[model samples]
Target: MVRLDRITTRGGDAGETSLGEGSRVRKDTARIEAIGAVDEANAALGLLRAQIAAAGADAEADAMLARIQNDLFDLGADLCVPGAEATDARTGRTRLRVSDAQSARLEAEIAAMNAALPPLASFVLPGGSLAAAQAHVARAVVRRAERRAVRLAAEETVNPAVIRYLNRLSDHLFVLARRLNRNGAGEALWVPGGARQG
Candidate 1:
């Protein structure tokens, strides 16, 4: 439904960008920062998906990542329009916002993926198969995005569901990484104080 005829609008050349409501704000504003973080997380997901496809990993995980990417777009849209609930005055149409159901779906996926994985005896080291490593990277980015969203929420009204979704997403990515690591077969567990030279 969105059309982009011109890629270079030269709109942000002045260090200000337009929000969904047509108001311009500095690029460094908290709202913009949150949106940028979400965008970065989405890009990370894309990279993870590429690694998954390259390794011929689980198709189900790739499918989940695809859905999460779309959800990130929805989250970005929700942030662009300020307010916990926003509606267009002329058309009386409510703006696109993140719903609790989306977050619930992520929780369900996380639970399902984690059900078969072995219990963790130690903390994960964030390296395993290429796809699993990529998943860890994506998880880190999502955590950063969640922090940015929380920062924005402190300064202004934000939909609680947006923050909830980001929180659950990071957890989902963590569990997915473990799942991609051959259900703990390829995972590297931390060895406390093992690196110390006696």
Candidate 2:
């Protein structure tokens, strides 16, 4: 467990922040950007969770979002530190890195959720119940986060599993949105070039 004794240490006032293991880097680094993107996705999940509780439905989806939020935090922890290995001679603490099993679990859940839903004949338009709307927002944010992580990987070594997790996570959110959309009955479908008078 990590404890915060002070919230404002005036540490980043100079536009520099410390990463894991006390390594300082500028706030605008690719790793920091990736972390921020994950944080944004997590915040979107929070909105989805609130909508879930308010509706008093989909308890299972709520639980899943809670777990994914925790996993994103772990991903942030993983990104903060540069080394792939959790423990090294330089930093002798056990760091939390995302596991392949976690990503696989998301894939399994996506498959299960999608099995009962009707096949999509058109693109989804991101509207349904409140919870479903929030899920769509989260899915877009997670996609952005995945792209940021991939960009970071190009410049530096990143855990391959984390990228996989983010990719699968976006899919999970997409299916979850559909599941919350009256079991895919209420999805807003987009018509290709159906608009404007021909």
For residues 93-174, could you state the per-residue lDDT of candidate 1 as single tens digits?
Answer: 8899999999999999999999999999899999999889988999999999999999999999999999999999999999
Q: lDDT tens digits, residues 103-168, model 2?
A: 988988999899989999889999998889989999999999999999999999898898999999
When summed lDDT is taken over every stretch of 10 residues in candidate 2, the lowest stretch is 86-95
Candidate 2 — what's its lDDT?
0.92
lDDT of the candidates, in the order given = 0.95, 0.92
User: How far is 142's C-alpha from truth in model 2 (Å)?
Assistant: 0.5
Candidate 1: where are CA atoms >4 Å away? 89-91
lDDT value, candidate 1, whole model: 0.95
Instruction: State candidate 2's TM-score.
Output: 0.96
Q: Give the root-mean-square deviation of each candidate in angstroms.
A: 1.1, 1.2
After superposing all C-alphas onto the true structure, candidate 1 shows an RMSD in angstroms of 1.1
